[model samples]
Target: MTTAPPISPRLLKGALIGVDLFNPLASIIVFQYNPDTMTRRLEPRSMTGADGDRGEAYRLSGAPKETITLSVEIDAADQLADVNPVAVASGVGPSLAALEMLLYPKSLAVIANAAIAAVGGIEILPTSGPMVLFVWGPSRVLPVRVGAMTITEDAFDTLLNPTRAKVELTLHVMSYNDLALTSPGNALFTVHQITKEVLATANIFNSAQNLGTALQL
Candidate 1:
């Protein structure tokens, strides 16, 4: 039996080269222009319960949400000069066409008929539909759905096609525990567990050391 490759997000985060975002479906990369910075956030569900003696239940009002925001640049000057294979095959340079390919899959409306057929044929819908990955390092390869994208076209060719762009992309992370028990998801889930354990252990160690110092033990 072949063991699944470990999902390591930490490896990506430590590199000075910066993070990479990619669409597994489109098979296109945005490594040419790395983002200036990336922001990660967690939106916890609001707490709610009955008033008075009824103690508030400490649980997520709903599933917690994670979001990542970043701005990436796309410039096709190299493609325009030397004929990039991707640009040539895409029939356009690194302008709107490339951006569209990178982003469209996220919002593409599912064909209901095709989806129905797929379920009937496979007995279950695939969990990996047009998902994008925010690869930071080894254990930090996060799967996310594109939440929003803003495109600013700064330059264009003579014919009015875009040449340079600044794209602000926001991604909503897919919570690991909710994903199907598949390859990357499974590996990612293992990483998540390891991270939790490490954090807990560190906290315990720190607390014990502090207590020992206070008591002069």
Candidate 2:
């Protein structure tokens, strides 16, 4: 008798994608293991009654400000066991560096600014890093800025290279109001909102159907 092969469920990994504003360069850091839990908070942008305008109390200025906090764990035990060259050599240093670089200005830009300053030039503009997108899933991909990060190195290899670490990240969602109208981040945020609305509508429809069945109406 022939037996069917066992089916394996597909798993998705969350990632952070950084796209340069003026160049074709991009950085994608896929999480090794998905976080166990993610915390999200939203603050509404509604008009306040303190303005003495009762009519404007129900008005909203823009999309709510949203923030997400998650803790990601990184470990090199598996790689080290398999004798991976990079892991054996530097442990998780490269992985840690990749995450840390999200908040850093480009080295070339920093050098150029310093050169200009050395020449007694003023009015040098500050450098901005690439725009980062926090992608939890298809429906949850949104532009975000790294508000804060805390890294804890749990273990190290013989060379003092970190073998295990946990990174706690606070991401501030960038809504349309926070980005330029012509920028890609703005477009992405608009699509994200539309997707959310569509999902909410679907949820309501399902709930109505269940309610009708329950009431036999």
Candidate 3:
């Protein structure tokens, strides 16, 4: 009898996808490697006491404010070892640039705004970048804004291109209150919260079953 080889489990990679607010299919950027660890913090939006109203003590204003922090690692060593042309030339510079661009306003938009200002246009609205979605897993996809980032380049090539780097990113989760009612982000957040509620219900059912078994009820 021939023995079959064991199959390895497939793992999904987390990613930060950028979609144009006006054109959804515009652009996307996937992380090179998944972060080893992630930290999340939540602050509840409690409407406890407004003008000493004790009746509203248990009321909530909206969804809790959430913040996530992760450190992404980028390395060009493997690709360079394989003699990849792009890696040989840029040495991870392009990857770094892609992440950095998420925080920048488009140059064209900047130039257009400058022209409008010169021509005496009043109240040129601030430009908005693409909508960023942080996808950790199927159930954990969230619309988020990049609050801050710190990049540390550990290794560099002879051409001064970064060969290896670590980027610490702080992301602020956007809730329904932060987005317009008709916006895609608002819809996503609503679905995310619904999913959480479903999971919580399932947990309650399982716990109740265990309790019944223990009590012989």
Candidate 4:
């Protein structure tokens, strides 16, 4: 008989590793752009009734936009554990300290400045209709919302769809290995004695900053 693999550091504070894609591939990424030089065309010559037709050329120069992509190496477990991160409000901040692929309990529409909007992004939640996780910043918290419909499974087909007990309601991020583990789902797995490692992290992005707080697995 084969034994199951031991879980990594114990499951802390209801956390899950998520990405739009499962089994996240560690990639080396960075988002940055050189200045953009724009040229304005001079206006066409037209008959001026009162004032001479005025036309001018102006140049706009600014940094281009790129989502910074960071690489995650599997062997550097020691370095990853040493990162001391800071916590911020649910909606505003980078999630360092530790690495998690998913985030949940989303908020409403996320408002970003013009620059933050230019890059590609993904929503971490299952119901946010796939958000955009751009490659532009350090470890950060990207807020999103999810529904139970997409993540849950219906049990025992019935006359009027009576198999509703298995409905999964909650948010989850894809694991570095494509796992949809979250709120009610975790309960399901644990209850069934699913011996898989809970790729779960703290529901709070900043919880990593306070090492003393352990997650509720």
Candidate 5:
């Protein structure tokens, strides 16, 4: 019935926590993963009696994996002791800890959005011309262009999965929002084309940055 508490926020060293298309994080050549606690279930089995009669079997549920977030496991019940309460004590108050935790999701969202834009653009128009490069991140939206808009597909994919196994990414492009506007002498960029391009290039850059940082580290 006992379980371990979840680990606190720890800054990933050398490599920045990126909101790329992956999450185990691309900078990881390998990691000593401490798996979340797991439980084993025990249930009764039905059998036929010597009198040629059988009994119905009942099902049982096992212990649960402790949840850290709504969809994630913090870890098992046993790993907390070695984790250093003194180190975690600094974050217990409602000041810095609460503030940082509140900001975490938004930070993730910003990075996720930006990565999506950068990746999508680079993937579709890796040529360094005519196309727009948009980088969406937690703090700002930056535009990236390889001189023009010339981006190589190989380069983009390479950046996302550089080690071929760095799979922690979370890239996402913003969806199209249609708006009515006055035309500048009957201009011609269609909603479909723009949407397609933007989504295509969204996450490529962040993924690339992630991979680049990982490889460098």
Candidate 6:
């Protein structure tokens, strides 16, 4: 049987890019996602009795969530089409220019006249924050909020401008089990549910076949 290629996540603006994380408006692109290790977390709740040797058995409180840490390389030297044009300006090398572009999206910036409090009911300009998305292969594509990002500048040019950087991103997957069904945040939760069910069913069949019906109870 022939297998079909996996599909990448669609951005909020409708374009599809094969990246682990990206912010369309900010022009941040993570071309490759490295060390794909996922951590599944289960929150257990235990009951206690007034008089008992040990507390009551622990039960799973809710659906499990996952966390993944990715190591991504960001360079102004990379000449991919997705790289922002300003990063590859004339006179200055692409890599140094790229670093400038990279910093904008992740850095906290305030818009003009965007006061925390508005007087006389004047409309306040909303401050722009990082727009991040987390995609884990075809099985999981999620809209995620950034937890932590550490950028390491490993290389620089004669001008002392950072040309290459290694960005470490720790992201928290926003699950739908805790959100309203109508909300878009639940999309990944729905996908995770399907993946879990399918794997469970497959395991049962595989185990039964290996053990054989005659040996089964």
Q: What is each predicted model's overall lDDT from 0 to 1?
A: 0.60, 0.90, 0.88, 0.28, 0.29, 0.52
What would you estimate as the lDDT of candidate 5? 0.29
TM-score of model number 2: 0.93
- Compared with the true structure, what per-residue lDDT tens digits does model 6 show for residues 114-167? 333433435665534433355555666665555666778776655666656776
Which is the better candidate, 2 or 3, if ranked by TM-score? 2
Model 6 per-residue lDDT at 26: 36
TM-score of each: 0.59, 0.93, 0.91, 0.16, 0.16, 0.58
Stretches > 4 Å off in candidate 1: 1-25, 46-56, 60-63, 81-129, 181-183, 186-190, 196-217
Error of 5 at 114 (Å): 29
The Cα RMSD in angstroms, rounded to one decimal, for candidate 4 relative to the true structure is: 25.2
lDDT assessment of candidate 3: 0.88
Model 2 Cα shift for residue 133 (angstroms): 0.9
Q: What is the C-alpha local distance difference test score of candidate 6?
A: 0.52
Which structure among the candidates has the greatest lDDT?
2
Model 3 misplaced regions, further than 4 Å: 21-27, 49-51, 212-217
Candidate 2 residue 182 C-alpha distance from true site, Å: 1.3
Cα lDDT of candidate 1 equals: 0.60
Q: After superposition, how far is residue 85 of candidate 6 from its true place, in Å?
A: 6.6
Residue-level lDDT of model 3, residues 41-115, one tens digit each, is 999898874575888878889999999999999999999999999999999887877777778777789899999
Model 1 poorest 10 in a row by lDDT: 11-20
Give residue 37's lDDT in candidate 6 (0 to 100): 46
Write model 1 residue lDDT over 1-217, tens digit each, in one string: 9999989764222211111243333434434556668897887765764552335556555446778888877777778778766544442344455445544433323455466776775454433344456665565666666778798888777766667778787877666545676746446645765786798898998999899999995
